[model samples]
Target chain A: MLYALMIYAEPGLDERIPQEEREGVTAEYQALLDDPRVVQAARLHPAEAATCVRVVDGRTLVSDGPFADTKEILGGLALFEADDLDEALEMAARIPAARMGGAVEVRPVVVQP
Target chain B: MLASLVGYLRDFDAAEEATQEAFTIAAERWETSGIPANPGAWLVTTARNRAIDRIRRDRTLTRKIPLLPEPEATMDEFDDPVIDTVIDHLGDTGIKDERLELIFTCCHPALPLEGQVALTLRALGGLSTADIARAFLVSEETMKRRLTRAKAKIKATGIPFAVPQADRLEQRLDAVLAVVYLIYNEGYRGRVDLGAEAIRLGQLLAVLMPEEPESRGLLALMLLHHARRRARFDGEDLVLLGDQDRTLWDLPQLEAGRAALEEAIARGGRGAYVVQAAIADLQTRDEIDWPQVAALYRRLVELTGSPVVELNRAAAVAETGDPAAALEVVDSLDLDGYLYYHSTRGELLRRLGRDDEAAAAYRRALDLATTTPERRFLTGRLEKL
Candidate 1:
């Protein structure tokens, strides 16, 4: 089955990490991406950089920030190929953001034939 | 039967439909042909055939066909064979392990705790969705949606229907045991028979995982508490354990609970459940061992770090003729919102000849109390003060 590990953390959290410990955190994430089960991985720009668009009465309403103002923003996402939800969760727990002041939401991807 | 069928079908909906169809057929056929010698085997064989036929008819279910065992065996071929052949092929030990698999899958940590409890009661306890809804005090539609969403997630997420591997077994089993205990506690507080349902689940778990002492310990704990259910109240008033009529207790069930606790001890079980079960057993004795009970509660507090256990330990300490120390322990705990904390503190204060303090504590307990019996008991204590 395919699962999406949606990583959520405070925006600019990477910038807050100590310079000495930053490389170790990056290495941990790199190790996770190296796993054969990880099909795709990407870290997003800060929520401040996001542009939100909404359709209001067929007129496009453009906004200057992420869709919702929240403490935690979408920090990263990983597409993983796992046998089951448990396997996907095992992969999610390895995400650096999950151990930090963040969370990972594991959702099953709908596979279209 | 549904458990084995689920193992065969690999789909909860399909297995449920197959089981229903099998029973409907049995109801009609049994009236004319008389009941079969082994009705369970007959139902299982019939359900498997129905499931196979249904899977064959539905094109979308073709993906699951590969997962089915003996896909080549046509429905006609299975008509007359001793139904036991299929059960034997499925590996029938004393108790089928498929139920354990079903339970583990239902109680999988990936699922929400509420879903796990409802699913465990539905799948393993053989409870109807309506009965589960009533027991949990939810609308039937809400419960139906809950079950539907849970089953859908299981299918979409590929939650496997098998016992957890050795590495994850302990944690997963604990989740399963916690769900059963939660059900038992809910039943204990309410008028519903969820307690019996929980005990039934505990018994099944104990049998399925004989090596896991916690399972037996949980069963023992529930049985011991359930044995005293009859004397727990006296006409809308809560009755303390010491004041309860002993004859009202279920003696045979209490004996069985003791036997289970001994088995757990023999297996070197020192987990939280085992320790709690040991404490419950000691409390039931005619000559109550207050010191031993306090010691067990201390161990429990270490194991769980729960203020409720500390409060219980304080209560036990007071019974050992040390009200002042027990009062100190109770005061240290941050349990102002807990009714039992206030009640226990009231009792300790009354014993120490602080009538005004005791009355205030009793009033606080009465304010926090939700049930009529609890409020009445607190009122009585205040009156005495």
Candidate 2:
């Protein structure tokens, strides 16, 4: 079971996960910590760090940044190991970060073997 | 090939046409000759000969090989990879260097990052759009579009058939290395699956950039990480660190990885890929060199700040000394969907013998785990407690 928990919440919400919502979600996530299936997690910085590149006229040039600029830059992503699509979706819904302006993208970790 | 083409004729169009023709000749001849001993020389000589012939055939044509307006440097010795390919196309048509450059150029940052690696995999990695789609979990159509868009950009930009130089080199090289490294990574350490493509790409780069340390390092990194493939999992599920059967690790790849890391360092400061390969060496050492590895990873964090790097640093710290210290670092991260965060924390807690907290971590990790192997690995850990 693997999930790419991409936090699409609005940016600049940094250090401010609304106290009530924060408490609820933190608790929910804290509970997930108790589950046996979790494998890895990661939180990303805002999208502003991105610098886009495109080649034109026998030259490779760069632009200022990402395609879309918004408050909710991809704040972070977490990877998890899971059983099936249903289980992954169920777990994704419970993500506390998702409750506060974030959307978690669940994807299976593609194993080569 | 680029170098040879330049030597053949300074004109971009002429060199390219000749190189292509040379390759056509090799592809036809190599099947019968069974690939010459020095494939590169073979390709280079053939392409050069083709260019010369083309000029000779042109009646209305040229003066003396369309000289470079200045004394053209002999293509005798240079680290430029594309040059070697053109040269190799001269004699041996057994293998073409287009596939490698296709990866390098596609990974060139001039094209958008989103599709760079995917396109490289398709053109250079030689994976089908479907195989790439399966790897990224995206649909084949999307992958195809992505590749087409990338090729269009390359066409539109007319990106030179030359290796980057000066500041521009710094900018584009990352995408190039990323393309090779990721391809090799997936190729070498395929999860639950065999990694033939990765090995193929690694060996291919080895041939293309024989003298380049990073090229060697890329292959070394794959060999090193891949050496641990068996120990990384059981027949059924993924194997977590501290739980893996270390004895099953591939000693040869690990040895090669160590040598590659040293070589990269000896080659002086390179880009991130070489740096990362150095760290992988530390991870694979008999007595893991945690502190140095931590420092190396910290440098990586400065460049990438990737959460994966953070988690890895924590693991290094935990291995080096205090599990609690590692847990503190882990707690500070914003990681949520990542499984290693919880799993690493859980292992630390379990080592401390805090059964409840460890169980909590295992549970959290399981909930987040996406693959069957990961689930099984986490569940097995849970049961052990």
Best by DockQ: 1
TM-score of chain A, predicted model 2, versus the true chain A, to 2 decimals:
0.67
| lDDT (10s digit) by residue, model 2, range B224-295 | 777788887678676665577878987876787777667766876464667677877767666777889888
> Could you give the TM-score of chain B for each candidate, in order?
0.66, 0.64
lDDT of 1 by residue, B206-227 (tens): 8767899999999999999999
Which parts of model 1 have CA positions greater than 4 angstroms off?
A5-83, A87-106, B1-103, B112-156, B160-162, B190-192
TM-scores of chain A, one for each prediction: 0.95, 0.67
Q: lDDT of all the models against the reference?
A: 0.84, 0.68
Clashing pairs in 1: none
C-alpha displacement of B380 in model 2, angstroms? 0.9
lDDT (10s digit) by residue, model 2, range A9-109: 77656457578876776677678766777676666656677778878998999887666776566666667665444455556777765766667765555
- lDDT, model 1, position B379: 93
Error of 1 at A38 (Å): 7.6
* Each model's Cα RMSD: 15.3, 24.0
Question: Which regions of candidate 2 fall more than 4 Å away from where they truly are?
Answer: A1-113, B1-93, B126-145, B151-172, B188-196, B203-211, B241-247
